[model samples]
Target: MTLSFELTQSVAILGGGPGGYEAALAAAQLGAEVTLVERAGVGGSAVITDVVPSKSLIATADAAVAIAEAGDLGVQLFAKGAHGKPLKPEIAINLAAVNKRLLTLARQQSDDMRAALVEAGVRIITGHGRLDSDNAVVVSTGPGGTDFDRVEADTLVVSVGASPRQLPSAMPDGERILTWTQLYDMTALPEHLIVVGSGVTGAEFAGAYMNLGATVTLVSSRERVLPGEDPDAATVLEKVFTRGGMTVLSKSRAEKVERSGDGVVVTLTDGRTVEGSHCLMAVGSTPNTRGIGLEEAGVQMDASGHIRVNRVARTSVPNIYAAGDCTTFVPLASVASMQGRTAVFHALGDVVIPLDRRRITANIFTAPEIATVGWQEKDVAEAHINGIVHKLPLAANPRAKMMGVRDGFVKLIARQGSGTVIGGVIVAPRASELIYPIAIAVERRLTVDQVSRVFAVYPSLSGSITDAARAMHHVERADED
Candidate 1:
């Protein structure tokens, strides 16, 4: 079927993140003229600062860990020494070189995004855009600076994105106290790193830095790490981190951060102080909703400054819609892209699939990556169906043993009565890549028996997944008997 829309209406998408760009592409494909206005580069925070850079840094850290563990697999290294005696192997990392490569890759991604949008016939405008009214947007050539141009559109998409939330007492100076966005500017590695929060971002940075040869201390206000993730996954991560020489301070909330000589001191709410050569505040992100003309234009926002929108991405005001991190929806690149597409679909009167929060999969990129889908363990415990949890340790897998992987497991949660897979958690090397089959299983409501029938490679790490499914099947059968 040919999908077409009335060309009379035009759309102006503000902010060029995954949401904005994807929405622009969708709109253009549906025959609506689109103009994308962005203050930063095309890929927004996901590319220019946060996700791309941090993941690239994590990749380097993963490589370092792999090298360090190579010796266990009988790999030996030698260096030239006096009299041909055995020499200690040295691994050197150039921070500047890593940053250069990271920025190069990020820029390439941004360029590709721009090229794709252009090819889709969307006009790209480099500026900070704000809605003047329901159907008009004023674009400023610079952020918080004057030179403005107003563009009129029949449909408005607000994908203004978000910024790093900063506490007044712990303001980031881009030096001693830093945000994740500022880490790319460093030419040298930190001697000691203190990461505040213990959330996904903090845990990820702490793990990455520790792997990269830095002494890391993770401070969390909660009783355990990763309060937002599955308890089992969090417990495994905490154990792995402590075993890897990371000092974790749970139930400790940072009250203030102050510069001390060349380093910084983070004072806890309990009056205890922790000092480190560098501190990264990974508390959370704030929506970029301030000064965006939302109130004047009758667009509604929630208490947390996120724009209020329905499943279709429609704002309180008709003809105005919001998507991405700026909206009340969960902040993820995948969710943002879907929200964008949904907004365009609803706006153009096309077949629209409302946003499904349940099916979205999220990953935390630590040494042993954590990936989850569908209902969480906490939710399953409180639900109607009795849940069975099966965990298969990677240590028992032949491929994991061969690869020298000691810390990780594949966990599957299934409904006790129906045997339908409800959720899955993978904690292992390349867990991100290994999570697709589980995600598909959960999405399709596949039974444990069905999942177990799929043949995984013998002696492969992925075999653990199938093994976990089989274990779940055994538990279900026992329960039935």
Candidate 2:
């Protein structure tokens, strides 16, 4: 179907984050005039504060872990002493320098994304933007909030994103008390970081800071660190955290966090108190969908204010679409990008594939990253899917053993009778990369037997995936018999 116009169709996107940027680019490529208005620079919180900087920081932490593990791999460092007796080299992290490097990298990425958007012929407006109606956006730009730029368009996409949820009892002062975004400001590694909440964000930071040589106390209200993830993955990570000297306080909840002299004190609901130099509130985030004129424009939203969007990223209003954390879909950068592209395609009469939760890839950037896609073992147990599971420990992998890696595993889940790949979990160094093939299998609905036949790099960590698939070959054989 063609746009009902002799002239080029116009599209306006508010908030130039991953979703907005992708939407603008996609719409522009489809022969539409696109205007992208952003409060911050391009790339939004994902690049500027959240994902990029945090992952870079985790990379530094991983480097620290590598140096410590190097000794186990027969790689040793020695320092000359006064008595001529060699002393083991101390691992020290120059946190200020690391923070500076990561911030610079984040800025560079943001700049690159902005450059790409400009090169794509998308008009860029730097300002705070809000929907004026279903067909128009109003931006507050220039000095002292005194100027305004209004854009009217044929299609509208909202990707305003979300912010770290703050509680009244524990506010982020950007110093002693911190949010995930405020962590890069520290000049020194936290002496003792009390991380509240045991979800992905909390577990990641707790593990990362501990690896970086900080005394970390992880406060979890749940029974495990990653309550929502695979239990086996969480068990392995919790073990690693304990082995690395991190204090995992499961079943604990922080009632309040207050400044105590130069440090902070956290009070628990059970009348317990924990003291630390800094506290990171990783409770979760709230969507930035409030007061955005979405309701005024007849856009439907949930009680929590997340914009409701269909699988194709379309809102209740036919011409309006929403994506990213602000929407009711999965809050992931990759998912956001896909939703953006899909939204534009659906809007402009192009082919579009609705998003599937099972195809989404999620990873926790801890020491040994946990990556997952598709159906999980929990789903089978909960009767959500009829599937079988096979698990192979990384320790049994030739490369993992050779590299002195002692933790993590590859778990694959497949349909009971058909053996069709459904979901998987990978817990290993750079599991994010390793989980891609499994994702492909799930997306293609390839059976375990088919995946087992694929030649994985011999003596590699990924070999465990093939091995696990091979071990589950009996499923296919049983059906054949």
Could you give candidate 1's per-residue lDDT for residues 247-273 as a string of tens digits? 999999999999999999999999999
How far out, in Å, is residue 40 in model 2?
0.8
How many collisions per candidate?
Answer: 0, 0
RMSD of 2: 1.8
- Error in Å for residue 102 of model 2: 0.6
RMSD of each: 2.3, 1.8
How does each model score on TM-score? 0.95, 0.97
Maximum-lDDT candidate: 2
Off by over 4 Å in 2: 1-5, 477-481
lDDT of model 2 at position 168: 100
By TM-score, the best candidate is 2
Q: In candidate 1, which residue pairs get closer than 3 Å at backbone N, Cα or C atoms, i.e. clash?
A: none
Supply candidate 1's per-residue lDDT for 347: 90
Q: Candidate 1: which stretches are off by over 4 Å? A: 142-145, 474-481
